[model samples]
Target: MNLYFPASSDKKTVFSAIEKYISDQQFIIVNKDENRPWGGFYVIDEAQAGFFIETWFKNVYDPLPRLQEMVSPKILVVAPGKRLSWQYHHRRSERWKVIGGYAGVVQSFTDDETEIKNYHEGDVIRLQKGERHRLVGLDAWGIIAEIWEHTDSNNPSNEDDIIRLQDDFGR
Candidate 1:
């Protein structure tokens, strides 16, 4: 599955291409974030473990609060072979980077169709507009960091778009 497109600033095309690649390999993309001064790619695995690594705002001399403002901005760890439930969001995309271990990511469609793909440390991925997705860890893993819109990442008040396609928790 080797496909390429010219350098693109088009976010939709960028995402679409990445989506196609992951899909072709049967993987899921879980997050996409653009509201920041920088961008992010967040992913998760079948064991419900997440990977959203890389640090930003390092440009700032003192970046602690800057990061915490968006999120406490810390590493995410998950056990191997775990997966998260299928769900969607009304706002905020997520970005993930595999920092350690291997993963099988699962991206889902509105109608419940899904594909599985794999990623390893140093790999990056993203999710977009109401895309139902999740991840499965192929091996014990941990994500270095997760940065998202402070107001949108996990605000329960705004989580009305959570439509679980399949759930182990009966979500």
Candidate 2:
């Protein structure tokens, strides 16, 4: 299970919720400065962040046994009215599933074509590499399960891969 908290929630609130809902060994907090204004993520897969046995073996032996896809999964909690930067990645794609509350999504396949839509619980959105996208919190906290799909096996994408075109927080 993943934990979710509103963006406006203070550290105490988040910690309290985590203590009540998540076990100490379940996840590790990896908060970033840029994400402070929005919401935080409870990363379920710690191996995706740093050196791991699976990644090492894959890197050493090109095309290892058919292993499960390398994915970084997390639960995103966007505060009401807060929005993430309009960004895209070159080495990864993403699949987002709205799990709680409502959300507004903006996606663009090309420079000239853009689409905005509202999503609710159980709705899923798929974003391909180089596709510009942003998620906005609606009336309540928006909880989403995000799965980062590493497109380039040789060079997987990480937090630094974000290429922001527009941002509300001047990120």
Candidate 3:
């Protein structure tokens, strides 16, 4: 947990460091997205992130069931002053927990109107499906624990589900 990324380090370097740390911790990093306009993310195994659900039936309980297909959890690291694209998903909603630093979130239920809010560590924000939303890093690296909740159980959301309306990097 004593990872460090110098201020001058590039995205690739930061991501590589994170990957190495994850590997050293015996956690499987399923994906690494380092080409984003803002910050990047690492999709890790659910168990590594401590994502588990307890189910109960007939006075009995199962404490180790994981909804891997219904949810995708990732850590989003946003660079200082950078923001994600104004986007929405058709098949999933999202819950973001601010885990490190501060962040600004912009959200809109309608395409023409939006609201912005700032959050700090421990704050939680929820974005429903089809809600236009974006995450902005404040003055430092913003780290967020995000969980994608797929609306349809049969089809989980993926990167292709993103519908970007505005992007600073022209993605």
The residue ranges of model 3 lying beyond 4 angstroms of the native Cα positions read 1-26, 46-68
| Candidate 3 per-residue C-alpha lDDT over 55-108 given as tens digits, one digit per residue, 9 for 90 to 100 | 101111134224655456677888878889889999998878775667899989
88 Cα displacement, candidate 1 (Å): 1.4
Candidate 2, residues 86-160: lDDT per residue as tens digits?
Answer: 988999988777766668899997654366699987677878999989998876677676767788888988989
| Higher-ranked by TM-score: 2 or 3 | 3
lDDT of 3: 0.71
Task: Name the lDDT value of residue 3 in candidate 2.
Answer: 45
Candidate 1 on 90-166: residue-level lDDT in tens? Answer: 66555555644556667765756567788766666666657777666444432333333333545521336556677
Candidate order by TM-score, highest to lowest? 3, 2, 1
lDDT of all predictions, in order shown?
Answer: 0.46, 0.67, 0.71
N/CA/C clash count, model 2 = 0
TM-score of each: 0.50, 0.71, 0.76
lDDT of 2 at 87: 89
Mark the 10 consecutive residues where model 2 has the least summed lDDT: 49-58
Worst 10 residues of 1 by lDDT: 45-54
Going through the candidates in the order shown, the clash numbers are 31, 0, 0
Model 2 gets an lDDT of 0.67
